[model samples]
Target: MTNQQFKSTLQALSLPANRSAIVGIKRGIERETLRITEQGRLSAKQHAAALGSPLTHPSITTDFSEALLEFITPAQSDAELTIKQLEDIHKFTLAHIGDEILWPISMPCFIKHQDEIALAQYGTSNTAQMKTLYREGLKNRYGSMMQAIAGVHFNISLPESFWQTLQTIRQNTQPKQAFISDSYLGVIRNFKRNLWLISYLFGASPALCSSFLQGRDTKLPFEAFGKGSLYLPYGTALRLGDLGYTNSAQSALNVTYNNLDQYISGLKSAITTESDLYRNIGTYPDGRLKQLNHNILQIENEFYSPIRPKRNTAPGEKPTEALARGGIEYIEVRALDVNPFSPVGISLEQVYFLDVFITYCALMPSPDMSTQQQQETQENLSAVVNAGRDPELCLVQDGQSISLKQWGQTLFTDLRAVARYLDDAHNETHYVAVIESLQKAIADPEQTYSGQYMQQVLNSGLDNGHFVFELAKQYKANFAASDYSVYSEAEFEQMAQESDQQRLQIEQSDTLDFNAFLADYFKA
Candidate 1:
């Protein structure tokens, strides 16, 4: 879709121009953790005793934007811009948003004595190890004793310098795995699963949460932030800008095409080797070499094969109509983590940070980033994730390495400006507070959640059980006094019944035996 067509469609939908969209993120996974706890309700004294009593504070409290762009126009549909309009928005976002990277690997895992002795399995997904540790035994062992901080992701449009920086990092060379893995998948799954739990607390009907949870054994629920969840909250969505807008049918087609295009591009880039595997894929003393191409092809066919690129259009076809023939457009923000200690499942601080980061991304200029620059961004992001609490890690920007705190400060400075704008434009005071707290965190790194996590670990001796339990305590505290618009007793009963029916429906729909599916899933 062309940019011009896209703008006119927005003029038609009359989507709020100045208002910002917000949604509650909650989860049932942790609630399930609480449900199975043997300790019943933990009293204040009991909570303190569980911790070794170093930094035992009874109470804790916390407080918690978009842009205009030239979107690709899609054909107009249903008197509104169609799906093609959305893709045009993404093209605009891609062309306009800027980003920053944080490294998650450098953070400490906070292993406790129980974790040390427990027979636990690491997840095969990105967050698998933590999930397996927490779900299988940690909840029983720790309760709410854990503390953790997740790395943040900011999507900045690629720029010329961004490419140069990444290329330099890749060329300089380092031995590390690049492909997504079980650990990565686990982290994402846990984080997303928790969002549903939070939403439950946010006044979403029990029916809604339960609907998402059907057939799930563990408390973890559906992936709430489906591909498009992230961008919807951002004020500067692809939905706006100049892009071609077609009728609704054409709009859907455009989104489908874009999604397929991304999948194909990702598959084409999935090449890896023994050096990049979690465990080297090659190096058998007895002899065989790694079949990198075979592994890549397998993933492509099994996973990405389902996606087909949009069919070609005849010459002179309108951008919106042509792309809308097939496709959908959506945004996926991947930086959020479940605030294990917060009842709401995410902190007001975290939410505000996301708003700030996304707004910044929307406003930043897009320069064509090189592969190397992307690698640098990726590496730096990992470092932030893993070592955000560490004061010494250096972040690279404009050809220089600066302390993580310094880099964060610089980022915060920019974010605050955006927050001020959001406040004026959307009348959101919460955004301002979020910016201030982020700035404070940058100034005193220990003040941030990551710092608190390290401190708790030191005081509690990294007991996985203790850490998880303590963290859960904090989570309870965060939401206990706060008003949670939850279902009443009578309402809850109705939802429970509905949940049973939903499960039955799912069971009936399955052709393969449940046990068979389970067998194949676990074996795979």
Candidate 2:
């Protein structure tokens, strides 16, 4: 789309129209940092201060030292940092507690195709091939669920039992894998560890859960952990399918109360059946999918609590780690819809827009306010998601209400300024297209993938098979056209083949001992 066309599209979305909200960080100023260092991993002085003897649950009595909370006074002069700017700190943290964060089981398995339609279009039918395909599909699907959870989980209450699990492990010996080199379980371990770190790092409050968990009382309520996106499991997906996107999960308490255990038990189910329902496309009959759906529903029902470090004065189990950190340097944009059309899964333009948005968020002062303000912010977010294309949707900023199109336009104007600054500092012109696309999305929401999804669904009557087929076609076409250096179509196909062979080997192995594998898994 042309710049003029994009601009015109923005005008109708009711977003801010000017450049005041935009703040750009100079390029070469260290956008993001990643390091796994032991040297600067929480200074001895800081750790000593931060780790004052652990607090008792529900009533934290600190020695009034800096050790209890990783507090940052507003006036303290830490240099302003962008989300990307924290890469080094993140890396260091990862290295310090790396193995704790990886969760291999969370990794999606591939589903190979056997027939020509499945093989030619979707790749091979071997276990590895199917697993690879499953992973891609799982990433996109899981990504969507996580995005949803991110928006609302912050308000959910974390349960004490879950928090205790991590704390128990942490106070004990450090897992050998946590400090090992070349750890294959990096991602999952990192995520799990970080979940534990929050209480120590942020002093997260259990009070946050009271409002959402009041009447239902299904043990600990859902918190910001998996509630947003990671909540997928079999039963939950079924519930989501039953409940449209607009309604909150809290509405369906009765159905959940009836079969809670079945739903929870199903979390580990594997989708073993291979009916034609999931033949060529990425869909599968794996019981695991059902379990994932169930998990999401269970979360929606507020059964699962996010594990957090311990806090005193709260009537819950303490997390192994006594404290957690909060205070956002940058909000992780967990909601990227896999552009089934893009080969690398996302475009340079998307990345640029993300960079621009995070910078904008960093520069803007928090819009903190009374309950009313929080409500307004929630409404604005909902509008952006549900009524993004309504043209008349309005958002509030600085005490005044503006149409979303106007707001978007104003935001992008600031974004453009940031992009210009970025270009000058980094000598990078890659962000220009992304800035242009944002401009277009604001002016005409229809240009967005969300809008496109709506259009296709409406045109095709929401047929799942057709929806997935078209998605595959879009992705394949994008793969053929783009020149992303990392993952080529040929490489992807080869990976699928190898994955299939591996699965077959495991299935046909002579000394297969499922019970032994289970024993080892739980023992660790």
Candidate 3:
């Protein structure tokens, strides 16, 4: 669509009759960080008893490793309230963990080898064992070192009210749920096309401690930062690039974000398809469970994408089954790196920027992507991750070349207009202003989080490890000095106790043997 046409559509959406429909934009955050000791070594401690059970806790849990803490905030319409809950989670966690501090970045603390990382454990139950076995499969398929890298997932959805209004505006004929599902798929398509901008603006892992490489050979041109660090001078998020969790095997899987049924069918196919490479790892080698089934993807979650259409599943329901049953309830953006500068690992400005971007994707026109176009978007996103700040870099669009700055400027014209409509609907004043700041960051790459943080490392002459440790210490001190604001200490204590009980109940409720449990789960 032309810029003027998109502007007219926004104007209609912002009319008094339709304004409040956009006000119900809901969001949730899932932030992950590794736990490190005072000296910056990865912690060897198990999941602390003071914290709730990692398996059942509503707010706190472990990710791939026991040391990697994942904090979840409930979905709320107000981003400020969501962030405040995150802060309270941080304060309550710090009060319990004695001296260990949360790492301030997406990349992990210095580790000698993958063996130092412990798999996250759940209490012994058929269900819990399946969870661990899935992780074991991940470890066997992709090394544990890659899983150690952390990120923040932004989950968002437009309420039913919003979708209803959108259907009316378009005068669509499909059923409400079907329309919502199709609309969300369009959003995913646009999101993929524009993901490069996100990586350039918020990506923060341009440098890494040399330990992450573990003497592996690489082709990317990386210069030495300090005694024990290697860096790409113009890179944005190395964590989203080849060094982090990758999908080289799934590249040919053809999971297109075209339509809900096709998308679901594509992912399900990978789960049941066997892989000769992973088959060699042996699912039950050494008289013990080494991994899950030797499939291209052991489960739906293993089909790593930067974004996914999600539905809260019923008991024993697979993710695709849930989607087919109820359609898309939300979209989880998995491309974000944990902002090292923010105490909560994501800043309010970042949230606001995403708010504008996501909403614009929903309102704008999105067509089905051809296979060639999908490949181009992936290649463009990879280019930004590896060399976003390089002035000489250009991305391919419609099989033509365009510089990042020029394209971003054009995108902001629509984004800023969308922000104005969001601000009016939400009755908050931050959207337009936040978009302005983000627009500036787009024009000037040095203003991006990765650019600023990497420059600090260069100027301070501290090794990557020492520099991150100092930041982690400062954030720890901040959390320590702050009092609980959103959740009370007593409330947190009660939740931990309740979560433990819930975990025990689940363990006791398991009726099937572990092997039978696996068989039953796959049958679903």
Candidate 4:
């Protein structure tokens, strides 16, 4: 699909009968943040019992560390509602966790040692043990310091009506689910190719406490700030870089996204393959079962990507199994750093812009990404991570080198067009307005979140710890002072109780020993 062809399709979608199909476009968010003390340290606490079980809770759960809270909102057609739900979760959480404040940024707070970060615990059911064991494997493979880095995942799915309209527009004869899966794969490919823009616009992890480096030497040309602070002068999102929540060992695995089967098969191969490095780590270190096995990947979730095709799984279903069973239900965008400026780590304008960008990705024609092409995309991302604000920086596309400004202009033009169609469909002006506002980010790199936030850090002369510590206090107070808008405190308290009961039921219902349960899970 060339630009002209995409325009024609947009024309078709703009028809009155088809445009209304977009009303059902669903989006959800999964935001992760570390629980920290008021003194700017990782909280030395378990997951708050008042918050609910980490296993059965639908809205709140712990991610890698017990102190790391993951807030989930149900998929909603309106982005505004999603933000509201996220805000309500924060309000509820802050009220429950006593004096502890949520880390308001992607990079973690000060840590003295890796042992201070405990693996997220989920009771004693076999399923719960499996979840904890997976974290243990992650700790053994990569240090826990990296896993403490936080991020936001935006999960989106086009409406059934929109897909039906497109299928009819193109006369696609494949089965409905198959067509949806194929189209979503195209979105994944395009998203990967254009992911650098996201890093430039929203990436905000430019600095961190020196402790995150774990006292190791770094190749990055980092400058020192007050006492323990370190930063790159032009860096955008260090969280997405090699130093934060990324898996370097999986770089050797060629995980392709050509089709559902190919993607799933590749992940399966990854988990099944043995690794001598991990084997040397000792799966049973001191006969205590440190990791699941000496495999290259303990499970499919360990294979990190900026974007992923997702489907709601049945009980005991693997992610790939869900995709294979019902095709792609949605795409989880893992590229975004937690927006430091927003109370909920995301904003309404940002969500509006995402709808435009995601729509453009789905509409664009995407060729199968060659291994070299994929490598170039990652190179572009790494470049942006370290020094995206440099005017001299260039990124390669289709074997041609281009300045970031020129490439960004091209993307915004297409994005603006998509935003207009979204306006026509959703009966709102926010989409195009968001495009126009964010378009300035391309013309002036300083308008980006990381660009602006880094200036504040430099000007304050306070250490990274005190700067973010001050900001976090404001967010904590805001959550505390504001009354719940979506769900009441009593309701949230009841839900926590319900979640605890559910976890207890699952524990009571366990029929097999942990060993037999693990064996049965692998068999599936």
Candidate 5:
């Protein structure tokens, strides 16, 4: 695909009957907080009984640590509606969590000790045991503190009709699933090339508690604020930088998104490839399973990319198996931080802007990325995460240097066109309005969430940790006081009861021993 071909395809797809692209967006938010106490220490309490079983809840679950709450929203075509539903989930969850406040920031600020962070416990079922064992492996590899860092994942998928429209434009002769998957891979390549812009614009974890570093060596020159908070004046998102959740082992895999088969093969091989470091730990230690295997990955989900090709797996089906069985059902964007300004962690404007950006990626001419380009992408992401707010920052693109602002403006110009198309298709001006507001952020870095948050903390005369903790309390109060607009109280109660029952049934129905089950799962 070329720029000219992209323009012609956009023109063809803009026909009145084909104008609307049915898009579905899903969100999974993972938040971690110190227990609601006068001292703000990590909580030792289990998942609240009132919030339902973490093992079986449809919309709520635990992630990494027992204190880390993850809320999930079903797919919706309307960004506003999707956010509204997420808000409702927050409202209902807050009402149930007793005194706990949802953490307002991505980096955990108040953790006192690694021993204080408990691995999430899903009950006695074989499957549940596997989940905990995998976490144990992560704990051994990355430490629980790093695993406790929170973020949001945005999953989006274009409908069959949207792909059919593209197929007609391209005269694609392959099977529909193959074409859709290949098209998604192309978009993913472009996403990798341009993700630095997203980190620069939306990254919010610029500062963190000095305690978070735990004496690790770093080149980052830090200034101290109230109560030992460490900050870099021009830093963007340290959470996505070297300080964040990363695996050196996966970096060596060099997974490429050039095609679906290659992507799946890379993932499968990583899952099967044994690691010397992990092998030393062994699969069974002290007569209990330490991990699923000594492989580089416990599962495909552990590959830890900024984005993933997703297909909702069937019962007992592995993620790689699902993609190999059926082409990608969606792509999950994993680079977003937990925006401290929004009660639900993301705003409607952010959602709408992502729609425009992802659509542009789909339509753009994305040449396949080579291994060298992959390394360059990582470098660009690092540059943005560390010093994106610096006016003179430059990013590598196609082996050439470009100013971050120049590339951002260029991308935004194309995004405006996308917004126009979306607005026309939906018979509304909302998408255009989103682009206009984001345009201001591009022109002025101070308008970005990261920039605004830094300024807010500085003006408040509080450490970053204390500032976010105050915001967390405020959000907790607001959500607790709000009425559930999307779900009734009865509905929430019913769902909780059902989830608990499902967990019980799963526990009672397990037929295989834990060791045998792990063996069979890996074999499958």
Candidate 6:
């Protein structure tokens, strides 16, 4: 905790009748994208019924495929008004995407095949056929082109009067959802022990498009380009490394965070265990169901974590029954990576340096990480997502070996005193000039955004698929020549006709049938 004990507990919670102690820094983002085409492949289109109803859109959706998409932005406490509401949801989804584009990296550059992608479609409802049967059980357990890899989540939260001013600066008398679910699991164990300093300061996918290794079998070396790209001259976010969403049955489910009932009893025993490799990938084969559960998690958001502990679930609960009925209400960072030099892929100084590094991972001092400090936080997040700007890199903190620029100059000198206590609780130096521009991307990893997008694809000799397909056609012509400053094209066409009449009133008020709604959603 010491950065002078979090600046004397933010000067005794900035007393002026605790002026709502820096006004509840909420936030929210989500992001994701893909919908390719003008020669950059992917797009087997379909999600555009004039951009809405990706299951009753509150802010457009579609994630595991049907040309990806996923924009969301509601919660806001001005991180430049949540990036001007994600640039007005990418200018109302590029004014209903007529000539596709969006895909500006987090890997997956171009693909001519992988059964030409597809998945996401939500029509008949038993909750939109269990959200496309959980992306057909993630394409029968990871494939449909590694679920078209995309990124950025963010979410964050901190208000119940800033956790009652950190439970009155720790003179604790618990229970307000158990001290905000154990202070959001001590900010997800100091954001998994300093989330590889946010994947070495916003690790942008350092290179790919060798059809995202569609013929797997790496041993590192990489290097090629133009006729099937592939890189690693010190890569940074090979989409959160091990070539994205690494899995061996969730690395044998050794999930634990030390609290929140041992992290919802290891996600309800990986959603009621069972799995001979997802029971030979068959929840229903010939008669086609293909994945609501042969288990090793056909739920609990399939346990992939770069930070989670969220809550907001209700109408028919389940996100572990809203954290076993109200506990950790928000955290969801999900290791970022989708800046692609921001044209709305996120920026406003990377959303005010991730609100000053998630408020210095909720005022530091977090401990409980064991299991060999969670395998030295996955080997310091795979050494900053595979060779973080390699000039003799090194990481793994609490178990020694430092120098990733001296642990990013000791976490930007404690994130410049948490960006000067959030610019003295919002009188605002804009989070101390976003910690002096992230301490110059920790003393120059070529001023980050994955080292200036690998020096703009090595000074534009083009080939990370025509340099992200000519910068995704100049960020879809600068989000179609921008204009919807915070919504209204007749309110996004009346929210695309009320998300297509609330998805036809939840498919005419259904009455259990997709196998009795997956047996009352896994009866628990």
Cα lDDT tens digits for candidate 4, 325-366 = 999999999998999999899898888888888889888887
Model 5 lowest lDDT segment of ten: 24-33
* TM agreement with the true structure for every prediction: 0.43, 0.36, 0.98, 0.98, 0.96, 0.33
* Whole-structure CA lDDT of model 5: 0.82
**What residue pairs clash in candidate 5, if any at all?**
none
The candidate 1 region of ten consecutive residues with least summed lDDT is: 60-69
lDDT per residue, candidate 5, 1-524, as tens digits? 47677678778878887887544334433333333443455667888888788899988888898888888877766666677778887888777777777787788867677878899998999989999999998988778888878888888887788888888788889999999999899889989988988888789998898878886788887788887798877788888888897887778895799998899888888899998878877555457766678889989878888889899899988888899999899999989888888887777787788888888899998888899999899999998788888888898877889998888888888888888887887788999898988888777888888899999999999987788878888887887778777888788788899999999999999999988988888887
Alpha-carbon runs more than 4 Å astray in model 6:
1-8, 11-112, 116-143, 146-177, 182-200, 206-285, 290-307, 310-319, 329-332, 337-356, 359-414, 418-438, 442-446, 456-521
The clash count for each model shown is: 121, 106, 0, 0, 0, 1
Among these predictions, the greatest lDDT belongs to: 4
User: What's the CA error at residue 521 for candidate 3, in Å?
Assistant: 1.0
Whole-model alpha-carbon lDDT for candidate 6:
0.80
Off by over 4 Å in 4: 283-286
Query: What lDDT tens digits, residue by residue, belong to model 2 across residues 1-524?
Result: 33343343223211232222222322111111111112211111222211121121111111111111111111111112222222222222222332221100111111111110111011222322223333344333322221121111111111222223322423435443221111111211222222211211111111111222223234222223211111111011111121112234323222211122322233212122222322333334562232122222211212222211112222221121112121111112222333323322233355455454543332232222343543454445434433345567666654688886775666667668656644544456756656875577657655665555434444665332234345444433443344433333354345434544543554565242443432342233
lDDT of 4 at 118: 95
Candidate 1 local lDDT, residue 462: 37
TM-score of 2: 0.36
lDDT of 2: 0.29
Candidate-wise lDDT, in order: 0.30, 0.29, 0.89, 0.90, 0.82, 0.80
